[model samples]
Target: MSTAWQDLTGRARLRDAAIEAFAAQGFEESLRSIAARAQVTAGLVRHHFGSKDALRAECDATVLERYRQLKEESLQADPHQLFTHLPASAQGGVLLLYILRSAREGSAAGRKFTEQLIDEALILLNQSVSRGLIVPSRDEPARARLLILQSLGALVLHFALNPPQDPEDFAAVMQDYYSRVALPTLEIYSEGLFTDSAYLNEYLLATAADVPPATDAGITESR
Candidate 1:
């Protein structure tokens, strides 16, 4: 498919092309092919971005930032509603492309992008906790990473096992999959793991005679 490469500035076109190529293939995909897709010389791509790694890093920011924006927008009331609330257009293709590609390469760009993805999910989880939907936990960061991995692993695996077909059908299938399966599976997560009666209550009961009960139901961090 031919794109109007000139419609974008040289740098923009290169970034766009890199995102396309990385999304279609992987980061290990040839820079020459990306330049050709952008209608520029391979050296021009290097001139614009220094190297293929840098180019893929730029693409990672481009696509994942948009993915984050879509996530933020869809998070209307409940953060747990993330996937189910996403529009069909924002459903799983490009983000998974970049993620899968980056994980395989294990390069600087890959690690940075992966960290960024985790950080973004952590932010959303914090939002949910702040909204009082999820209780805060001492292990918020680790739990956030687990949540991100759960969603991402499912998406990455879905793409691997069942490649994209008709766009409408794919969206419907994904939406159904999330509502019927993923949402329920992750439903307990939004409650925060510490909510279980296993420890917090017992701790409170044990300490009841020693100190006044802490008003905040969330776990406190040990200094």
Candidate 2:
């Protein structure tokens, strides 16, 4: 532990330790082990967090809030800085491991965490759109939700099969993951998937929807 680590209150110490323990070992990791990691007693863990499940919930909230802070800072400074800064953050690997485990575990808390991620992503995506950094969507909320789900779902699958041997290796693994996917992802985002508007036109006609057909750029409304 560093000087800063030594200065934390017992509850903060226990929570930080629990986040590391759960990220490394999974939620089944015991309170005694977490206390040992924190260099605090098991009784102190109970005093602070009440139960293992409660502590896990705290970890979930903390990780999400920290991620939100990082993203907001990156966006406010420069959106492009996210790629350069996020992987280098002190808690980067641990945070990634914690979120990956939470999402893969499929518990009620995990599901809620994913939904909360989508909500945050929606807010941030809209902010980017307003800043002219991202394209506006016809249905903004749905677009944000879909993009969040797609990206996270792909990450979950990729890391589940090819997880880092240790939590500290997460940044490297993420770099490799992004290196492999970046070209294809950027291509699709920039060039688009469809060759033309034939599919959209056909679908609109077939469905006879109130919404007008899409043009070369995107969906357009009837004047």
Candidate 3:
């Protein structure tokens, strides 16, 4: 292969390896192990990625890419039906791993990556607000951050308690909680948050696809 082809192939392999490693072992895994999995030398991994932090960032980006792609596909498919297939536990597990790893390390790379993750999450929440899928209230940004943190906390708690035997279980609980608790609370915060019934329907559909519904029927007594 040409030099350009070689570089592209190497980079692709490195990215794939990094995603697998990060998903499995998180940021604490050794660089050597990641490089080995990629069938590349550590020097090569460093050459392409610059540093361990850079590599971790790249891995985080890859994971986010998966999320973005899923969201886009779901929106395109039947925005209302898109979330039905979501894997709640796996998604939660991966995100939890990233957050915990970053907090534990407190490295510049970890902090930067965590901030980027938070920013992206806020952007998504804001997008939902703009679309009227969510209620718009004071401190929109803060609300978005709080929601993301809550979701993250739920995943962390689930992992600590369950350790995820079946990923679907995680998704089911997440979906149920969001529908009964999260979505209704947001709606109450601002009825104007949703543009129409379609938006609310889509939100429920997508969330249900992503996680399981609550046990007490679709309507929770509190909401």
Candidate 1 lDDT tens digits, 89-123: 33454555566667656677767777888998888
Name model 2 segments beyond 4 Å from true.
Answer: 1-8, 79-82, 168-170, 207-223
Model 3 poorest 10 in a row by lDDT: 214-223
Off by over 4 Å in 3: 75-84, 88-100, 103-107, 164-223
TM-score per model over all chains? 0.66, 0.79, 0.62
Residue by residue across 160-217, what tens digits does model 2's lDDT show? 7777666645566556665667679978987989878777667667876554344532
Candidate lDDT (C-alpha), each: 0.67, 0.76, 0.61
Q: For residue 164, give model 3's deviation from the true position in Å.
A: 4.2
Which structure is stronger by TM-score: 1 or 2?
2
Best-matching candidate per TM-score: 2
Model 3 gets an lDDT of: 0.61
* lDDT winner: 2
